[model samples]
Target: MLTLQRRQLVGHDILLARHGNHISTMRVDRQAGRVVAYLDDGSVDSAPNLITPGLPMPATVRSVLREDWKFFAVATACTTGFAGVMVAAAVALAGLSGEPGMTQLLSAYSGT
Candidate 1:
């Protein structure tokens, strides 16, 4: 069984389960305001209540595996590191280009 501490956020916040051993049981972030969840594959999954927008919120997470919930702390750390890299890239691009280009970047390397 899982146990999660309820969270409150004004904007987007993602939380994954500490336990990822079971692929069948999906971990999720219970959306209250503008929050949404991202799976391991980087796909989004929101609580049905969030999708409805005005309807009563259903309990998305029945139980939080105390063990599984802890793993989320690690995910959050990784996200932080990635965000730092993104910020540095954005800054470098701005410095070099003076503006964000509208063009999409094509891959430089092709598969064999």
Candidate 2:
């Protein structure tokens, strides 16, 4: 990853560009409206602007599936399986409690 940082040094704003173990410095010339990059070989390079705008990349369904389909599928399957187990358990318990089931339990608790 590339990271850019700015600091004030001796009344001048200096930009530091870091990538991995390599570090380089750049000087921001506000008066000239240009950014100067100092190279490792002691050569200076200048750019009109810091960042250039480019066209956006198109999103594809294959890319989306490649990135997250497995996770989504597993999550959905697990949720459905859990719900099925809970429903089956509730039905079994209701059957064991006889015809009234939860209604009978509630009436007994209410003393009516």
For all candidates, the clash counts are: 7, 0
* Residue 112's lDDT in candidate 2: 69
Tens-digit lDDT track of model 1 for 3-96: 3445433222223342143223333344434435545565655433243457533233534444367678889999999989886775666566
| Per-residue error (Å), model 1, residue 95 | 1.2
Q: In candidate 1, which residue ranges exceed 4 Å CA deviation?
A: 1-65, 98-112
Instruction: Indicate the residue-level lDDT of 101 in model 1.
Output: 53
Model 1's C-alpha root-mean-square deviation from the true structure amounts to 20.0
Candidate 2 has an lDDT of 0.56
**TM-score of model 2 vs. true structure:** 0.35
TM-score for all models, in order of appearance:
0.30, 0.35
lDDT minimum window of 10 residues, candidate 1:
100-109
